[model samples]
Target: MPPRPRPRPRVAVVVFPGSNCEQDVAYALNWLGLDSAYVWHGDHSLDGFGAVVLPGGFSYGDYLRCGAIARFSPIMDAVTRFARAGRPVLGICNGFQILAEAHLLPGALLRNAGLKFICRDVALRVEARCDWLDAPTGSVLHLPINHNEGNFVCDSATLDDLRADDRVIVRYCDEEGRTDGVSAPNGALDNIAGITNAARNVFGLMPHPERAVDPTVGGSDGQLVFQSLLQQFTQEVF
Candidate 1:
């Protein structure tokens, strides 16, 4: 007798009026053999989704700040509840801004120091072991970033806490994975490009990992994130 097959993990990609990356997320998840669907901003419930992703895009036309307006969407309440349940929630680029606005994560993303929209591939150094990231510490991942307001900033106390708890998951670095001031794109404070909540289930990053999942696009380094979530589910729930 063969063992029962594990259930496929279903992911929800939240879609707002102005969201443009939900399809990208869904496609990436599909490539990984996971089931995924878009949840409208008014859905009010996450139900059976095994994971939630806030993909990169100009949500709500980026009005009233990047993610400020989207934070009040009816679905955010459900997202907050889902995150509090220790489920894996990932926020990418503009999604990161929404997570911060909802207070699921700390800090804010401000205008880039250069004051221009940047779109390019960047090297990210995996710095923390978060639930959604299994890359070894110091591994370099190539992910694309496209944003005008990607500079990450937090108050001194919040920064201290994030560092003390090892919640800063990744940092913009060079190809060699050297995280120093010279590698800080958008002039992010302390060169921080990503971080997670103290619980490690809620992760946010400035780079667009979903965009890197297809080999034709660039590299599949970003697939590690989704793969890591699958690994986590197998290890802890199977």
Candidate 2:
């Protein structure tokens, strides 16, 4: 009998000093029955994983900036290479900020509009089609967000370019669940919550989809994102 074949779409979740979601992310992937492992920041090696995820947390205690220091870790050296190679890379929350700092994408993450740390579950709408999931065009999602710097900003030209490229993903909506397609004075532009880089392989978002993998948690929309990626991985495994 031939080898069953190693898991396709293998993923590595980078674990930094203060990463609070490493295990949760690993668990989410495991629940989806996809092969995933936690990679150390100083490892400098990805072991040939097909995807990489930078989970949420105050890495280096949010010193300097959320993901600023983690970007210099040995593993990021490999991350830089993997991302540039067009492999799938997902960054959530602080991970988003780090990606921007690494120049893997445009824009910077700033403090929330109210200048206060926020920790609560929120809803997001998928505004753009993406390979991240078979997410329906107008799907609404709910997940937790805990951050002091979740604001997204970029120059006008760059913002226009990203818009032209269809890089924007999720966005925040109003009480009636309506959105104007612009970030409110609340930090995000067009209420943007997530986006992918130019290569369409690197993705980053400010919400915690992994936290909503189960319906008992009061929201199941988060599951689709992981499900879509897992399906993609399963297809690639063959």
Candidate 3:
């Protein structure tokens, strides 16, 4: 018999009651030739999925705080288990907030320094490489960020640890890739736009890479994020 082809990897995109970006994330995954399925927040299992994504949205209408209530969703328990197993997990925008609230990642997102919602394309400087983001160090990517509370803050000790361990994945920057606070849209500490856990399997970012996958609409720099994950999956790294 001929050698059988390996099954394509499938990703689970978790959807909470107020989640609005699940479809966008699924679309981006499909566009990248990966199968994706919506897993409701109430679901208790994450079996048979190669990776998980918590896309951006106002979960529970952002009451109390962004992602505060969503952290208690039944599916989050599964997500926590999956992440602890060294599986890949991605959290974007509001999703990032949920992860922080769940203590999956360090730090909290505060209201924007301007106290206004920001929705626009922003430049990001790739600071480190991992399973999710394979962009070359110092490279710049343009991704859209839409949120009211995107200012990332943490205690000085945590910030120092993240920097010392090279867990800071991306930082807001100028078009030329300068990461000075001058270009930080939400006043995140050290202009951090994204970060990875110590194991580097879990990633969280404030920007929306799914919104920037098509060049005709904006640019395709966001593809790098998904592509890297897919590549890692292909290598059986999960």
Error of 3 at 79 (Å): 0.3
Clashes of each: 0, 7, 0
Q: Write the residue-wise lDDT of candidate 2 on 60-139 in tens digits.
A: 99888778888888899899999898878889888888888888878888888889888888777777766664676566
Which pairs of residues clash in candidate 1, taking residues 3 or more apart in a chain or in different chains? none
Q: TM-score: which is higher, 2 or 3?
A: 3
Model 1 agreement with the true structure over 10-117: per-residue lDDT tens digits? 889999888888998898888887789899998899988888999888999999899999999999999999999999999999999999999999999999999889
Q: Give per-residue lDDT, candidate 2, residue 196.
A: 86
Alpha-carbon runs more than 4 Å astray in model 2: 1-6, 175-177, 181-185
Quick one: best lDDT, which candidate? 3
Task: Give candidate 1's TM-score.
Answer: 0.96
Q: What is the C-alpha lDDT of each candidate?
A: 0.90, 0.81, 0.92
Error of 3 at 137 (Å): 0.6
Residue-level lDDT tens digits of model 3 in 126-210 = 9998779998999988899999999999999999999999999999998889875464889899999999999999999999999
Which has the higher lDDT value, candidate number 1 or candidate number 2?
Answer: 1
Cα shift from native, residue 95, model 3 (Å): 0.6
TM-score of each: 0.96, 0.91, 0.97
Clashing pairs in 3: none
